[model samples]
Target: MKASAFVLLLISGLPAAAIAQPNTAQGELLRRGELTGSRPSAKAQMQAASRPANHASDPAQQHLLQTDINLAQARAEELPNLYERFMATTRDERRTWTAPQWDAAGEVLARLNQRYEQVRTDLPLDDRLRVRSLQGEFHTLRGARNVKEKLE
Candidate 1:
């Protein structure tokens, strides 16, 4: 009974050891060029080394990109304030915003839209879509204001 139990234990452990063992056949295949490792070849490594480094890490380029991003963010932040101010005015006071205030807002919107369009390719998809949505809102607000002005 003791010998039988020992034999059963050894038998159970054998399959696990077999599964854990690395296949020597894989090494043979690699020696014959039938299998490849994940690492790039020497030629590929040399080509990659010869290529120019990414410009994004350069201080001047990074500064310029950051500046543009800041300007875009500032413009985006201003939109909400402008909308709030426009909404705050009474119906009687709507005309007060037309010439100077509304025109300035329109100019800002146009400039922001142009800047966003110019950089859209550089921006991530979500940010590009956000800028487009802002542009649409600007147009909608401008149209509503125009209609109100015409009604008056």
Candidate 2:
């Protein structure tokens, strides 16, 4: 048993070492171009993005776009429909999303919740219930994706 465990550890360490080395595509710390500096900070990125003078809407330019989930047109009467649309669009796309994409989705979901709060009093009882159910469905999709990735 000891010999077998040693062989297994040896086999595993090779791949782990290879993966640990920094590559061009991904790593904990990526250099900035050929300057040997670290990756641009969030503030640096925002400054770079807002640098274009021809673009008058600086706020619009600064907003991060990750997924296609849009709830801007949602109202009290249309909250359920909007939530359903969000669920449908995100169901398959979340599986392939990276960490940044997931963060963006979470930001959008928080915004949706804010909208719900603004119009909750105006929403009918059944529609409100449906909206809650749709939110639950979105969470379920996230849970399943996590489980699938863990299994893989």
Candidate 3:
């Protein structure tokens, strides 16, 4: 019954409501807001008008990928080292990271994941396993941190 939980519940039900009650006014609104296939709905303009603009004044918001190293350029051989470095900072310096900072870290993690996808076969078995392990740990820590933050 928490406000956040209630909001989450309402948001989750929107797609179902859109399909289940297409004729209802609420469902009509939801359908208008949804993206249809590769194209947006005809009411996309109206939905866009109702949406608020983003606030990107924070440094973290401006620069989402803030890994110390050039993660985007890291090769397959360096995947383990780069992942280890980022994970270490996430555990240490990033312990106090706000949502925006974590967002940047997530971007870096995603970049690493993309690189891994491209060069996974070229990487040694140990390196591949290490990269995957780091990826899993990153998600686990992020989720745990989110829970901890919510509880606090």
Candidate 4:
């Protein structure tokens, strides 16, 4: 039983070491500029877009967009506290949160990012940079959320 347990542990440990090694084939190909994945068909991409076909604004769509804008603005306003809470909760190395909590945090971060993008576009370059720095906390929180989900 003891020998079998040791063998199991050894096998499980091997893949972690493998992950530490660089993939030479991928690295070389990336250096050569060879790439994979199909380019989106223009027609298909157009059809896939959520924007209206007529390019005429629909009231419902406009309302939804406005709501998105509002939510982002609100989040931007309260971003500091949200980040502080997230950090405080996750500060302990042994603390773990459920996937839902992390996912919600990620969603909030994405919303805050959208808000930041919109706000930045309306500001001067210098102000945009400052705002971006302020907004970075949301991105960090979102990343932590994703990490928590994956760890779970």
Candidate 5:
């Protein structure tokens, strides 16, 4: 009976020893910057290595980034015009908007929403908030238009 109890205690302690052994291997891997299962793919690792530590000194990359920013800004500037057209047509009192008019407005709103989402990360916090507010307005207008059509 004493031998059996000793064997049981030894078996239970083996798992604790196994758990402790992992710290040595994991610590060495951590020191070497080589993660096991979660290591980055070879392509991503190569890209990361090739990138300069100080990116601001890379003129070509800087130019490309600036060009992208300029294009995004240009696209963002068009939002106001699109929003104005949507409001003008939807708010006009001379006649109820037909299906085609609603379709056009929806298309414009979709475009505006897409552009905002694409460049929202680059926008200032205030601009991001404003874009969200504008999106909400677009959704409200769409709902109101739907209700009007249902009533008609």
Candidate 6:
């Protein structure tokens, strides 16, 4: 059994670049360290973390929504480079959960921000909260990028 596993590993490692497509968030996380063979687990955590709260109308909530939007846009711009960094440094045996979470978090922030933006503009709470949330995710992604670099 161990020998077969070794063969599988050897096969998977061959010409990795030729076999792989461009690296995206999902791809990077799935192919990295702890996450390599645990995609289902990583995906579930993301869904739970991103679930909407019950009190959408709260002032603080609104502000978070706005913050999330702006941050998402900015992060989206950096995603290409960020993804490259993740792929270069990450090994199949060292998949990082936080790195995958970073991608999921950014996506959730952006979606929430867009949703809140459609509502009436009079509520400062909404805009402020959204932007803050986005910023939080952006920072998270930035940190993840740094970790990936260090690993490299």
Clashes of each: 0, 0, 0, 0, 0, 26
Better of 1 and 3 by lDDT: 3
Better of 1 and 3 by TM-score: 3
Q: Which ten residues in a row have the lowest lDDT in candidate 5?
A: 24-33
> TM-score for all predictions?
0.37, 0.49, 0.54, 0.32, 0.42, 0.27
lDDT of 1 by residue, 32-142 (tens): 111122234555445434533223243322222232223233343443333333233322343455555555444333333333333344556665555455445555665
CA lDDT for candidate 3 = 0.58
Off by over 4 Å in 2: 1-74
Error of 4 at 128 (Å): 3.9
lDDT of 4 at 120: 35
**Residue 78: error of model 1 in Å?**
13
Overall lDDT per candidate, in order of appearance: 0.42, 0.53, 0.58, 0.40, 0.45, 0.40
Q: How many backbone clashes does candidate 1 have?
A: 0
**Position 84, candidate 3: lDDT:** 81
- Give candidates' CA RMSD values in order: 22.2, 17.7, 16.0, 17.8, 19.0, 16.9
Stretches off by above 4 angstroms in model 1 are: 1-96
Model 4 weakest lDDT span, ten residues long: 28-37
Runs in model 4 deviating more than 4 A are 1-94, 124-127, 130-152
Q: Where in model 3 is the C-alpha error above 4 Å?
A: 1-72
Best-performing candidate as measured by lDDT: 3
Pairs of residues clashing in candidate 3 = none
lDDT of 2 by residue, 51-135 (tens): 3223212232123222333344355786666666656667757768775665555544444554565566688889878877776
User: Tens-digit lDDT track for model 3 on 1-152?
Assistant: 69999999999999997676323122122222121122335574455346333322434323433334454355678777777876777787557788867776774554455445556667888887787777778778888989999999
lDDT of 4 by residue, 10-59 (tens): 99999998886434222111111111112334543343243222311333
Clashing pairs in 2: none
